[model samples]
Target: MKNKSGSFIEWLIPFCFILCAGWLIWHLPAFTLDWVPPDQSQADNLRGLHHRNDVTPGMSGPFGGEADWVDYLALLGLPIFLYIGIRTVRRAPMEFESWRPADRVSVFIGRVTMMMIILLTSVMLYEVLLRYVFEAPTLWANELSLWLAGFVFLCAGLYAMQQRSHIRIFLLYDICPRWMQRLFDTISTVLIVLFAFFLVYGGYGEALDKLWRWETFGTAFDPPIPATLKPTVLIIVSLVAIQAVVNLISDWNAEPVIHTAADDIDQDELEKIRAAVGAEGVGDLDVTRGSIQGNQTERN
Candidate 1:
């Protein structure tokens, strides 16, 4: 019964997210067409939603309110979407090579970031199709894309740090002894923590103010990008710092790794290619099937 309940919840969360996303997209015409005059054809033709004339001052809902009651329900789903995002990441398979065991928090954020990318792409595609092909453009698509994109960038940074895939020059560190490597790692982690500390210290007040006021983009669509993104930047940077500390502790007594060009190669991708081309086709290439199979065995 416990397992069944758990499985049910697992399915329910994602289903809710899909429903929320679809609801928001469906209501975009109503939510963002506030600038349209009531007498205008566009205003009258928006699936019976009247023009929003009585503008509410300040954010009346979480991360800023939507156009009306219908829109507010979609906004209410944001927290649930965020929770499901975390759960998704925590449950993801750890397939990538990293210095430590997969950080569930970072992985969760990474999956959310991926979803944001897809959402961003869909928004852009929708905008492009409407503006060029259909002779109708949305006021909210650009702003919505920008909003999703900002979160994507911020979340990806934390994921990259957790995966140790962030930009770094290992030429000098590769030659260092294990103790020296540990020292280098410690110094780098300290620097990251300090950077995060000063950033939050300086921006906390401003971020808090914006979030409190729920600052909107001064545009037709009027998204709360500034309100949300400002606080998110500080939050994600702090997570990156914490993940760095975790990595340092996790790697303290680990084996010394030698950096090389081959380290950049993705074995899983190569395996896929080999599978697609078959043994005979792979033989035509430089890499041998024996070596590929050996790597797969070792990885498994």
Candidate 2:
């Protein structure tokens, strides 16, 4: 009981951290560090000889101060998110050995990738702050951040898949018998694995197009990063697909036991039994009287 209680506490700690991180990310855009106006004066200053008729674009518009400020904040906020993610993954209860071999690698990869994100976040912070704030903004920071985000997303997906912790509504599964639950598990696993495979295959062309075009944000935010994220996406998807296969096999051979319902007496009977057990505290006369009553009832 004590061991189970400790495990429960461990699980709750990470859950709470994730909840808070999500809240902060949701409100990040609403809280900006600087307020800049985008009126006519600001637009005139931003305008340069690059314009054909010397007419300035609207300040605080799409390419205006507000957008850049928000993006910069996002650049800052992403690190906090990455740090929380890393800590959560690192401190996650490690029962991976109990998992299937195929699934174990996915878990390992997910956790390590999380660590990499932390390191990458630090590098990105340096690049962005030094180049933009102190001196001048560099094209590298923008690309680097995007690349890191891509990996972070892909790794997170695999992690979720490995844990079998994805969003699922188990209303029907809750009441299902052991055999039926096993059937559903098998079917679900096959479907998910196939779906991931197709996604990998389909994403390849899009990835290639982005790579060929040497995509850039057409602003101060550009990087020479490769467009080979298709392979990364495919690999992560395949890992998840394999993890599903592992889960399917594990469920196949495992005992189909319901966790909550122990084969003890029902609640009412248990309460009666508790009362009878407590009756030992009464005087000997009461105990003798109860025994006599029980004897008479049995005889009847």
Look at candidate 2 and give me any clashing residue pairs. 131-136
Question: Candidate 2 at 40: error in angstroms?
Answer: 50
The residue pairs in collision within model 1 are 89-108
Residue 243 of model 1 has an lDDT of 94
Report the Cα lDDT for residue 225, model 1: 73
TM-score between candidate 1 and the true structure: 0.68
Shift in Å, residue 116, candidate 2: 2.2
> Model 2 residue 243 lDDT?
78
* RMSD vs true structure, all candidates: 10.1, 16.4
Those runs of model 1 whose alpha carbons end farther than 4 Å from true positions after fitting are 1-94, 97-102, 275-300
Clashes of 2: 1
How far in Å is the alpha carbon of 49 misplaced in model 1? 18
